[model samples]
Target: MLRFAPSPTGDMHIGNLRAAIFNYIIAKQKGEKFLIRIEDTDFSRNIEGKDTEILSILNLFGLLWDELVYQSHNFERHRNFADYLIKHDKAFYCYCTKEFLEKKKQEALDLRIPFRYDDAWAEIQKKDNPKPVVRLRGSFEPISFYDEIKGRLEFYPNELDSFVILREDGIPTYNFACACDDMIYDISFIVRGEDHVSNTPKQILIQKSLDYQKQLGYAHLPIILGESGKKMSKRDSASSVSWLLGQGFLPQAIINYLIGMGNHTPVEIFTLKDALEWFDIANIAKSPVKFDLKRLRYVNREHLKRLNESEFSLLLQTQDITIGALGKLYLEEASTLNEIREKLGLIFSPKDIDVTYEGESFKEECLKLFEVLWGMSMQGESFIEYESFKNEAMKRSALKGKKFFKPLRILLTGESHGVDLNELYPYLRFYFKDILRIKGEK
Candidate 1:
C-alpha cells in the first residue's frame, strides 16, 4: 500500500505534487491500495480548504487515492502510542524551558564542547516536578535503513537527537504521528522529498519501538531547485498548483513535466496514462533536479501538440476564451487550441499597429504587403510556393532588409521567430479576418 501524506500548511507546490504523483504511480502500477493522509500536525500553520484544494488538483491530474485520512482526527491514536512508549521506558519526560536550553547551548558553545541537547536530556531525566514533554530514548549505536533509491544510508547515535515525540501542548509531533499512521494504515512504502532523510532514522526507531510488522521501503526524491541552484520559493515562480493552472498550464503537462524531473525513465514524454504504466520508485534519481522553465515550456508545447481539435476546443471553453475573433482570421490554419493560444499575441488590435507604424516613411509599403497577404488564400498555394511569394514580395517592394521582415514577423505572429511565414500565413490570415469582422460589427 502507498499513502500520500501532505501537510495542509499552504498551497500544493510542485514539490508536494511530485511526491504525490510518484506515490500514485507506484500504487497504480503495483495494483496496491493508495490513500491520502493529511498531516496537519502544525495546527497554527494549517490553511483552511488547503486539503480540499489539494484533492481537487490531484483529481485534475488523475492522481486519486483509495482512502482519505486526517491526522487531526487520529489524536487519540497518537496519544495512545506516546503513552505506550513512556510506559515501556522507550521515552522520558523533559521539562526544560527554551531559556534554560538556550543558556546551556551557549555555555557549551563558549566552552568549545559539543553543543547539543545532552545537558537538556540529563536535566529532564533528573529534574523533579518536570512539566513533562516526551522524548525518544535513542540507541547509542548507529541506526541504518536502506533507502530504495539512495541505498545503504546509516546515521550515528551522536547525529540523532532525543527528539520530542509529544509536544508540551499534548499534541504528538510529526515523527510520532507519522510512524503510528503508517503502521496502522499498513503503508508498505514511504515516498517523500529528500529533505526528510535525517528524519527517516528517527521514524524507523519509533516504528521499531512500536513493533511494526511490515518493513517499509523508503524513496526520497530529489529537490527541485531554482535557476540559481537554490530551493525554489514562492517568489521564484508560481508556488501553488492552482497558480500554475491559473497561469494556463495544463494539469497533465505539469504532471508529465514533474515525473521527468528526478526520475530516470527512458520515456521522455509521459501522459497521466504513461505514468501509471511506467512508474517505478527504484527508477527515481538520487540527484536533485533543477526546474527549467524552457524544459517545462517544451513539455507544455508537446501536450498542446497532442491535443486533438475537439480536446483543444474544450480547453478554450474551460478557460472561458471566446474564439469567435480568432476563428475568423485563421479559419483553417488554427487547427488546434494551442495554435489559437500561440497566435493570441499575434492577433493584434488594428489600433496597436495603427499607432506604431501608421505614418512612418515605410508604413505604406508595409501595409501594402500586409494587405496583399491578408486576403491571400492557400487553397491552390502550396507552402513551398508561398515561400516563393515571400521572396517575390521582398524583390518587388525593395523591402528585403531586416527592419522590413522584423516588423512584418511581429505583425504576423507577435513573435520575432516561429514556423516559417509560408506555413504561418494561414493562421495570420485567420487572425486578421477575425479582427476585421469584429471591427466591422462596430
Candidate 2:
C-alpha cells in the first residue's frame, strides 16, 4: 500500500499536491491501495477545515485515497510501541531539561566538540530523578539505508542525538509515530519529499528494532522550489493550488506542469491518465524542481487549447458564463474553442489582466481602433467583417503602424498585448458588448 500523509497546517500548495499526485499515480499503476493519513500530531499548528480543503483539491485533480487515517487517533498504539522499545532496551528515558541541554550544547561548542546530546547525560539522568521522555538508543557505528532516488546514504550514530521518541507530553514525535503507522498499515513503499531524507535513518532504526525492515521501501521525491531558489510559501501568489484554480488554471494542467518539473521528458503536457501510465519512481529527478509561473502558464495554455468544445464550455460555465453567449460572439466565425480561448482574454474582468503600455500616440491609436470596431457594431454588421474595415481606416488615418494596433487593443481587451484583434473582436461582440459600448462612448 501507498500513503500520502499531509499535515493539516495551511492551504494545499503545489508541492504538496505534486507529492500526493505522485503517490496516487504509483498506487494506481501498481494496483495497490492508496491511503490518506492526516498527520495532525501537532495540535498547535492544525487549522480548521485544512483536511477538507486538501481532500477537495486532491479530488479536483482526480487523486483519491482508499482510506483516511488520523495520527491523533493512533496515540495509544504509538505509546504502546514506545513502551515496548524501552522494555527491549532499544530506547531509554531521559529527564534532561531544556536549560540543561542548551548549556551543554554551548559547552560543547566552546570545546569545539560535536554539539549533540551525549549518552553520558542519559546515565546522569538515570541516576537522578528522571521525568521519562523516551529516547531511541543509537549504535556506536554508522547507520545507513538505500534511498530509492538518492542511492545509498550513511549517517554516523555519534553525529545524531538520542533524539526524543515520546515527548515529555507523552505524544510520539514525528519519526516514532510515522514509523509505527507505516508498520501497522503495511505500507510497502514510502514516498515523500526529500526534506525528510535525514529522518529516514532514524525511522529505519525504529523499524529495524521492531523487525519490520523488509516490509518497507523508501523513496524521497525532490523538493519544488520557487524561481528565487527558496521553498515556495503561501505568500507567493502562485504557490497554492487554490490560487491557480482561481486564476482559471485547469487541474490537469497543474498536474502536467508538476510532472514535467525535475523529470527529464519531452512531454510538456499530460492528462491524469497519461501521468498514471508514465509515472516511474526510478525516473524521478533528484534535483530540485524550479517553479516558474511563465512555464506553468504556457503549459496551461497548451492544455486549455486541447480541451473539446464541450469541456471548454463546462469550464467557462463553472465561472458563471455561458457557452451559448460565448459562441454567439467569438465562435460565430471561428471553428474551435481553442480559437475562442485564444481571444477570450479580451472579455476578462479588468483586474484579471495586466496591461502595460505608456505613450500618447499608442493610447490614441488604441482609442481610434476601438472607435472603428464600435462603428462596425453600430452599423449592424457582424464584427467578423470589421478587420478589413479596420485596415482601411488605419491606412486612411496614416496611423496604420504598430501604434495603431495598441489603442485598439487596449479598448477591445483592456490590455496592450494578447489575443490578436481579428479573433478578439468576435468574442467582444458576444461577452463584452456593453463594456465595448461604454469604451466607445468615452
Candidate of highest lDDT: 2
Candidate 1 colliding pairs, count: 3
Best by TM-score: 2
The lDDT values for all models are 0.73, 0.74
Clashes of each: 3, 2
Residues 1-442 of candidate 1 have per-residue lDDT tens digits of 8999998888888988998888887888778988999998899999999889888988888887799999988999898988888899888788777777799889989999886665245465345535667788876888888898899999988877687899888999998898889888888888898999988899888988877756788888888888888888877665577777876677888888888877676688778787676677787778878988667767776776666555655676743223433332343444334455656534554423333443343445446555555444323333345567577656555576765675566555544455566655644444444443212223
TM-scores for all candidates: the values are 0.80, 0.81
**Which pairs in model 2 have colliding backbones?**
366-407, 366-408
- Model 2 per-residue lDDT tens digits across residues 16-44: 78888878888898899999999999999
Question: Which parts of model 1 are misplaced by more than 4 Å?
Answer: 119-130, 318-342, 345-350, 357-433, 437-442
TM-score of 2: 0.81
Q: Worst lDDT window (10 residues) for model 2?
A: 346-355
